[model samples]
Target: MSIEHLRARASICALTLISSLTLASGCSDDGGAEESESTDESGESESTDESESTDESESTDETESTDETDTTDGTEETDTGNLSCEPEGDVTISYSIEVGALDEPPSVDLDLACTLAEIDTDGVTQVLILDCPELENVAVIDIAVSPDMSLPLVGGEAISMRYILEGPWWFNTYLRLDVEGTGHLLTLIDGDSLLPPEEFEFTSPVELTAVYDLCEPVSDGCGQRERLALMTTIAGEEAQIFDANYAEVGGEEGTEIWVGAAGHLHEIECTDTPDEWFQVLIVGPGEG
Candidate 1:
């Protein structure tokens, strides 16, 4: 069971407390992602296209040449790449933004505006900028947040495209994702459209079997029962939580959870599990 298909190339940044974005725009790899062949369990197909490197340590110091000028802080580095995901604390709420590329067609810079509380949260979280090789395709066009939010966006060539933010009551928008050319494997659609991803596959590390359970008791409703789950086994399917440990989980079994280096595979649940004797271990997301 060697089923790879998890992009996520790192190089994620989105620092925009509330303002400061000056795009210059330009990107082109034409419309990539039309080459696939990754089969290993001994079936042999190999040829995933090869080109993975989002370069994100907090990257800054443009290079790909477009019209180079700024020396470092002189202000004039145009290859067009400015990311902003803000909304972690002091949240006022209300959002609206839409900007497309790759021929370009989705537009709506900001339409709805503030005020809504019942339970609509997840302001913004999906950033990775600076390396916009002029941007051949950078679209998040129509950012509407209010009771409907489900963002994922990670790294270039579309690593984790998961967007669904219905609007109406609070809006603030700005989205541009084109981290250095080669077609951004885009997909963030539910109402307004945007789709691109014909193929993509890459996976190499395998060896799993991790289970842990202790949830159930929010008066039985199990709101998330304290939280402390960590299942595993990706590709073979049926057992994937990756990581979640709110705090006390006693006796820790082996314990070693980093969950990074591009291995994302989330699928957590908590409706009930008072404990029926479950605590198997043997996890790995480390030792890259």
Candidate 2:
């Protein structure tokens, strides 16, 4: 009876042990599968983040490249159009003496001819009177002239001349040949001058610059009052010649005058030099 009982008990215990071992192994397999799934999900999230960062970097680089192209185009626009001054209208000159002198070829342009007046007025004084309605100045240009003329007033080839602005207003100025020899139209500047007149030399070439300053008037011996005027130098050197005076008192602007020899003149409108220079032209007559 004791041997049979011991054998049965041992067999039942062995079966129970086998079932417990099987259950523990199944639980371990489930935990390992969950850990593998968690690792795969973390790797996928990191890949997505890397892709988005690369896309943002490319977009930023493209935006920076576009701004560099626009800055280069703005520099080329300022070179060619420096001075745009031109004659506003028909600029003419007249004299107080006889109309017999043949002003045939002396004119504003190189090829254009002058107006020849054939009137035989019997006047004792032979003065070159400048009457420009546009310029608004009734100034005398020349004190004496031959009833007969002998030279052609040419531009870019006239005689050089300089003048000192005498009297308060540009009422009077002294003139002479700019070069050593005479008998030529001394101060005919044909074109507009360059800007920023500082450090400029008034040489043989017809170039004028400007400076902003004050002007005052003067009274002559005959009790005549001259207006405040503009003064310029020859090649930015010696001898400041009086060019123009304020047309009216307390006026902010004035008419520009180009003083050429034999009283050849041209007047243009100019604004008040409020701060920077507003293109003031200082020219004189040279040998023609």
Candidate 3:
């Protein structure tokens, strides 16, 4: 009886061991599948994140590029582009300029609103990057007339008005004028901002009735010596001032003739100034 019991117990134990091994193997396989699935999910998530990051990066790059392009376009418009260089009708440029006077008050301001008489393309136009906005449409008026003053113009008059551009950044400014020969400096600026002033004697208006008044014909009121001096002053050229023809106030000479008038080429007289004197109404160089 003891041998039989022992044999049966050994067989049962062996069967239990086999069953445990089988269950353990099945659990291992199931765990491996779960682990693989988890790894695959993690990989997918990383890939999605990378894709999103790449898209975002591309979007940011495009935005930056667009901004750069816009900035470039805007800068280009500022340099050479003008809202209106040529106004519709007669453009009356009202500006003030101040220059350093050679005399006292190194700062001499000239506030003048001159009518753009005509476009005199005798001077050169410079392509400068001004710090002022008003300079965007800068049409220089080179021919300026002298207003009918006590001491009027005998020959002609053309004081070049300069453009003064000055500000904090690259877009601010004013204007100025050192009245030729007068030495008295004047500017057409409103503020006290430091500016880089530039002058253009290039163009004038078509029909500008500038303040400059015509000179009087040589006469006793103007005086003989005075007329010669006037011609020399306005002609600008010392050589040519009294080089033109001359006439007496009266048809006849020795009528207490003080000086000479720019009468004509043929019908005229020579003067003591050596150079003949032909008087023009306008000063400087005027078309009329």
**Highest TM-score, which number?**
1
Q: Candidate 2 residues 26-57, lDDT tens each? A: 11111111110001000000101001000000
lDDT of each: 0.19, 0.18, 0.18
**Top model number, lDDT:** 1
The CA lDDT at 278 in model 2 is: 13
- What digit string (tens of lDDT, one per residue) describes model 3 on residues 22-121? 0000111111111100010010001010010000000101111111111111011112222222211211111112122112121222233332222222
TM-score of 1: 0.20
Q: Write the per-residue lDDT of candidate 1 for residues 1-288, one digit (tens) a residue.
A: 010110121111211111111011111112111211110000001011121111111101222222221112111111212222111111111222221221211112211211111122235422222122232222222222212233333332322222222111101112222212332222211110011111212121223232223322122121122212233333333333322111111123221222111111112122111111111111222112
| Candidate 1 CA-lDDT value | 0.19
**CA error at residue 121 for candidate 2, angstroms:** 13
Point out the worst 10-residue segment of candidate 3 by lDDT.
17-26
Worst 10 residues of 2 by lDDT: 17-26
Residue 176 C-alpha lDDT in model 1: 22
Let me know the TM-score candidate 3 reaches against the reference structure.
Answer: 0.17
The runs of at least 3 residues in candidate 2 whose Cα sits more than 4 Å from the true structure, single-residue gaps closed, are 1-183, 187-207, 216-236, 243-288
lDDT of candidate 3 at residue 97, scale 0 to 100? 20
Each prediction's TM-score versus the true structure: 0.20, 0.19, 0.17
For model 3, the superposed segments whose C-alpha errors exceed 4 Å read 1-155, 167-171, 191-288
Per-candidate clashes come to 20, 26, 38
